[model samples]
Target: MRILVTGCAGFIGYHLTLKLIENGHNVMGIDNLNDYYDVRLKLDRLKELGIDSDNALHQNKTVASDSFKGFKFVRMSIEDRENLPQLFDHNHFDVVCNLAAQAGVRYSLENPEAYVDSNIVGFLNILECCKNHNIEHLVYASSSSVYGMNKKIPFNTTDSVDHPISLYAASKKSNELMAHTYSHLYGIRTTGLRFFTVYGPWGRPDMAMFLFTEAILNHKPIKVFNHGKLERDFTYIDDIVQGITQIVENKHTAAYNSDNLYHLYNIGNSKSVKLLDFIEAIEDEIGLKASKEMMPMQPGDVEKTWADVSGLERDYNYRPNTPIKSGVKKFVAWYKTYYGNSNE
Candidate 1:
């Protein structure tokens, strides 16, 4: 399969791209490489994929990977309405995994317009390209944040997401609506994965896994939101990638979802862990205790999140089995390797 992976430099996208290429699929990746987090991390991810850091950001110029044959990358935002269609036509991608978006809930409160531009506008462009080119499948990222204030133990796909509290959550809900419209009207096969708290090695700096690790390593006080009473379904990166891969490759039929053209699934560990317990896991792994700064919940923040991945398990045999203890160990090991040589 020849695939297009948007936001290829991102945490999830980078990992997914490697998995796809490893499975013998030809992949073309694209990212704006926005500085929402450290651009150096993005560059380093690209570097692992054999993309030269200096040349990975030239707009519209595609760079082929030196390490992997049939793997290529471009530095273009999916929101680029003009060139996206051209790229689609030129490449004729069989599947498009749209992971590119302005991610982050708290940031959405500060820059709501960025969410609109990247999540809404950029997604519209993707739908248009798929409809125009008759693309096979469009698998995109959604968030557990959409299940805002639901009071449900396991956040299921059928749960009402009409009351999203944050702009970021709203944007993801909007993406699902947009994809459904396209699927119903134009027969575009689409699947939306509502990801829970995804974390692991090469993870985003803004996420808890990276933040807690960095803070603990440097002996900085880690902010304990909600007075250390929050809970999350911390799905490891490998398990998340596995769910995605299975969905992308699985043969869909009318038996599943809305006539095989539209589907939504929760990709998560299906177990919620307390914030303090998670922090303990990090501390135990790093062998360094973090100074805690207890704080109230920020606006648009939820107390807990758990995923109902039963649908995914039944359909794709997806089982997220990475225990919290083991996952933290892996991330800690990678963090040491990655940040140890700071001046390299």
Candidate 2:
């Protein structure tokens, strides 16, 4: 299978791309490599994928991997109207895993346009390209944040996600809607996985796990948001990649309401770990106590997030099962090795 994985330089995308490559699929990956977080981390992820950082400088140019022959990467954005279509026409990918988006929920509040461009417009471009290219499957990254202010204990796909608290979440919900429209109209097989709090090796710096680890190591005060009352279903990277691979291979043909072959499911660790416990896990891993600054919940933040992945397990026979302690330990180890005690 020839797979097109957008946001290849991203945390999840990089892991997924490597898994696909190891499974003997030819993968072409693309990312704009924006500095939403540290671009160096993205580059390091690409380096792990066998792409030379020096060779990935120019935009719209394909960079072949030196280590993995089946893998190739490009520096591009999904919002590019001309180049995206051109890439589709040239490659004719069998499947597209759309993971590229403006990621952070709080960041969306400050830079809403970035969310609009990447999550909304960019996702539309992906749908258009997939539609025109006769793609067999389109697997995309959705978010648990779509459950918003709902009082539901374990967020399910069947739950109403009409009220999103953040623009980032709203944009993700919009992606699901857009994918459904395309699937219904064009008979495309689309699956949206509502990811819970994903964390692991090569994780994003903006995420809670990374921030807590960094601050703890450097003796900086870690801000305990929502006064440490929050809970999250922190799904591990390996489990996420496994779920994605399963969904990508298992093409959906069932008529979802007689419109198109479309499905959405929660991909997460079923267990919701409390924020304080999570911090303690990090503390245990790094052998450091965090200086805590308790803070009120910022705008557009949810009190808790828990995913009901029964639907995914029923359909795909897989669920995220990584324990928070183990996940945090792996992340802390990776952080220490990657940064080398540099507080920069």
| Tens digits of per-residue lDDT for model 1, 261-335 | 788999999999999999999988887788999999999999999999998988789999999999999998899
Give the range of the ten consecutive residues with the poorest summed lDDT in model 2.
Answer: 251-260
TM value for model 2: 0.96
**Model 1: which ten-residue window has the lowest total lDDT?**
251-260
TM-score of each: 0.97, 0.96
lDDT accuracy of residue 47 in candidate 1? 93
Go through the candidates in order and give the C-alpha RMSD of each one to the true structure: 2.0, 2.1
Candidate 1 Cα RMSD after full superposition onto the native fold (Å)? 2.0
lDDT of 2 by residue, 115-137 (tens): 99999999999999998889988
- Deviation (Å) of 1 in candidate 2: 0.4
Which stretches of model 1 miss by more than 4 angstroms?
252-258, 341-344
Name the lDDT value of residue 252 in candidate 1: 64
Candidate 2 colliding pairs? none
